[model samples]
Target: MMPPTSSAPHSAGSAGALLTDARLGKKPAPRLRRYYLEPGLRKELPKLHQILAVDLAHVVMLAERGIIPATQAARLVDALRDLRADPEARLRIEPERGSMVLQIEAHLTNAVGESDAGALSTGRSRIDQGATVRRLYERNGTLAVLDRLVALQDALLALAARHSRTLMPGYTHLQPSQPWVFGHYLLGFANKIHRAFVRMLEAYHHLNLSPLGTVGGSGSPWPLDRRRTAALLGFAGLVENARLGRDIQYLADIAAAACLIMNEINDLATDLQLWSSNEFALVELDAGYCGTSSIFPQKKNPIALEGIRTAAAQSMHWFSNVLALCRGMGSGDLAMRSPGHVDAVFETTADMTDLMTGIIETLIVHPSRMGARAQLGWTTASSLADLLVHQGTLSYRQAHHAVGAFVRHCVENDVAVTDATAGLFASVTGLDMALTDAEFRSALDPATFIAACTSQGGAAPEQVDALLRAAAADREADRSWLDTEQHRLASCNAELDRAAEILAAARPAGSHHHPDLAHE
Candidate 1:
């Protein structure tokens, strides 16, 4: 009775064309009838259609199975498979008479036809269509983000290598604690990024499931191969339950991934902002990533780092918003119907990815400055403590306490730790007449201290070497995954191009041609 789930989504021919024209008042851009078909919107479309394609194929299979008639199934199948650019590239429509008034469309052509209603809405409602679109977005966006993360990892690796021998003062409690290789310090940040990457990759798997066939709040009665569709889109599989698929639970994975990425970015940005300041000046960022100051002409502001910091704050807020959106709502459709959740999450993610990629591309090293900073402040004081511990005059715990006392005395007396350490050691042990120059120099040489740290995960060059090698292998694995994704996207583009060519050929010679599908 409910219009028999009409075979076609819209009316056919000139009427269908007018249906596109009907929404012209809403979108002043004079573009596609569906906003999603606009250049900007189309750019956001996901590649997981390889999954949607499968779902649609199953719909065709349903028709083939005689669950639906041959003509209707063929039309639906054709609509699904067709990749023509929406003629109404950013068109939206509002029908005054119907409950289904909020419909929008994109690049409607032969498949959409002259019908006022087409197969796009035949067996499914906009609720289901929106869900499918969202799934495609999440799946593809996750893949893209992972790729960008890999690039960032590569950039950090190169930076670490470039500054391997560069020295820097390691800090604790806002005071210099020890001397370490610049590479070792850079690798510290890299380790954080690596862990974040791993968390995101695991989150991606959670986001990669298909939600396409979960029609409306439930699912279609017709037989559908959700698994086949997921495989097509490269998703792990469908969300097993229909109601759960449409619930806010599905979107939470994306939110978690966004939070992890922004958290990592925030930490790194804060560290860079602090280190790049006049007070620290341990590293000099490239001019390309900086900005001019209006009030202060000499200011070479680290705008990139600042922007990342700001973006991270916004992204964290987005994660909260997403979680809040899912928190109190009822089951079925009411649980998470907010449009902003998907849109904001996507925007924040896209912004973060672009910003991070740019930072990686333009980042520079100032190893000499870093090393010089490390050389000051009996930064080697810790090594002297280790020396005492090694000589059996004191245990590590006792040495730690003695070092603290020595540091306090030096600070109060306004003398360097070396000056105080000899007297303090002699006072404590009543044995040392005078610590040798060789001993003092060995403790002071940041390099020797670093090399002496031979334990696992120590700042010793060898320990850092092991970490660096492991990071390299991890980076290589990330690159390999990126290569696979790149190949997949390439194939999508090729298919899209082929579809465009086919459309161009099918059109009447005098008909206006659509622009070619292209990437930025």
Candidate 2:
């Protein structure tokens, strides 16, 4: 008793139909739509709205230049406003109807008249629109990740400030080689993060160029004001060459920036994972960020640190995928506009930033354990060698040999460095290195060794304090930059809204051009 299901192919009876049928099909398979097309459209809807806002600005400019009729532009702007107000309208997009843009056009035609809705696409192509959307997305994503990086830097500086005198062993090839304050170790990572911020800013500069007027990878036929559109959309300038505007190089640049950030996160996670182990016990994470073994109640695992490492590794994989997708593809290839590839790059980068920020903000440090470990493996051996070279009559090479022999002697006798004596020193160097007991003990003390490293950028407390101050200043500058960027974007949106309002007012009251104008 059920009616027969309609299997008729979708008819190419309109502009939307023509574009959709050419790229997809009259009727795409359900699995393809569910797996690729529908998901792509859903993800692209927000970006579609953003690009449409810019397109409305373009239409306004065209109207001011007498390229489009004033009444038609007003009606188109009204339809755009209607679309903006209704979030559900974006979800109404069907795969058989074409891309999100085409569907939006179809919606506009239904809301406004066909003539005015069609006029909106007069001087533009999907190529330019797609490029501009991606640039905007990347620009916003870069600023967001940069904000997180600054916060992480702030957290690190705070921890470093608190631990300026907290002694820890500096390692070389997994072996304790020298004594340094934990603050100095933290400052090293902070500097690397600052560099990552700089690199992201460079990439942001490149991606800020507007591509809205580079129609179809060549140029628009109409006399369009590219700079005007750029200013209206808060872009720095135009991409200039149409072909280059369509290039995927900017995406690759973003990927590279992401790779830098993830690499730093990986390094930090590696350190935290090692330090939190039972053998090291140098730091303990907060219970909120850790987990216990399902079968063993005694296990407190640093699960968040492990997750950060995994996320960082996944970011590298996403970067590789983006690079491979763009490797040899010529400029303006449709494949370069793949939504899944682009989304993976942006989403993974943002996720990694958030993960790292959470990890840095909540973890706890144990200074006593760090100090205890700082004294092991003869961490002050280099200081002792330097003391022999300077305070005793020995060549530098002779001093090194003496320190090597001394370490071997300690190993053989199983004696701690703290228990070393003048007799032991004389036996190793084969000379009566004259020094009082206090002086000999001072040379082997980790705290004394750290204090004696008064060179610039050393582990000395004063140097660590100076580095913390520098990091604070750097964080302030980055905060100022972020504020400026956010204000610019906000101002652009306000300007666009004002422009739309002025255009909408120009239409005659109760005009038959668009009925929704009154309600809007």
Candidate 3:
């Protein structure tokens, strides 16, 4: 539906009139329904429960405030509950009607007649109700994504814990650069994803505020207790500005967080995709996550990672679209504020995270292969440079140049890193190799390089263990947030159900005493 035309509620039997008098005297064109109204209805199907919850809470609040008679409120509440109970049977989007409230009115008219059903929007407009529903629905999407992210992080942390000392070649500009620990790499992802999780959770707090009572960007004539509806709907607080309540920046924040999440997923998935390839063979996806190429007999493709990358790229496009649509919109710019498929992006993001978590949990690592590759790339050259600075009485830059020259000499002479000697190093760099044979070999050892990296956030086993503990704590905190929010929302829903049932039962006529009314 749309905003109410005036402060007054529409007449009883003329259902859908609230959206009708948009200064357009005629009904929406049939073409409009096909292009716009039809798809909007299908989108609302997933949001049907949220729509009813908002209406139920509003009607109960009206009853609690004595705005409508107790008997009428009882019927209205019961009718809404009925619609909620069997929505598939009771609700349908008529092309001509083109409004959820209208459908509700038709069903309510059947149950309680139109006169009482007309009071359903007593102190509110459909616009405010829609804003409220959007918030609730998006809250659910946010939590769904967060739940998956937490599980993904937990899986990453578990893998990191097991492979604390596993060695690999770290890359710079896609070229092998240094010795790296797999556990440290995974922890980096854990930390990165947690940042986006924080952004989403923060946005959720702003998103949780109630916009229900901000009817048409202004308060209505009735003494509508906004707080009562907020409580029933599980809002943390009111969206204090009635106008600003209609739209908020949290939608963009959520979109941005989703983009960041997908971007992180893209990077990780790209790495996994590469690692699982025939050339790298550092890791392999489980058979369940792989797909056999129909045309190629021997190919077991890393299809899950490919799917994640595809979804993530789409999310970036959606993120850019959200920004494009949201820019230059006013506070009440309903047309563009809820512009596009932010919800779809959220669904896709959560799905990909779930997919990644499965991939990580069932992954098969080839440590021997990873270590063999790590040792072959002269990845320990930097460690030798550090040793030169310490023992060769050379400056750090001088040492870097010397090591660079040695690497070039080894490449030109077809000599492996293990074949380097003091005479060979001296011949290459024209400098004395102050480090003895044992010291030089230790410096070139990939394991020794990683072990010596004792700085915080380093590849050293102890450092990685510290990061693993931090990651565990971070994950625990994230889990606590998810659990607490789920419980809060669940308990609020139960209370709403209980209150609706309480108000729906038969009550004494002309006796407005309801248990939900605040104590004087």
* lDDT leader: 3
Kindly list the per-residue Cα lDDT of model 2 for residues 400-440, writing each as its tens digit.
89888988988899888778888877886686768876788
Residues 321-398, candidate 1: write the lDDT tens digits.
666766666554553233454666656665776676677557666777777777777788777777878787678887
lDDT of 3 by residue, 12-85 (tens): 44343645657776767869877876667666667788989998998888988899987888878876776688
Runs with alpha carbons beyond 4 Å of true place in candidate 3 = 1-25, 331-333, 506-520
Cα deviation at 493, candidate 3, in Å, is 1.0
Report residue 366 deviation for candidate 3 (angstroms).
0.2
Instruction: Compute each candidate's TM-score over C-alphas.
Output: 0.77, 0.92, 0.92
What does each candidate score in C-alpha RMSD? 7.5, 3.9, 5.5
What is the number of residue pairs that collide in model 3?
0
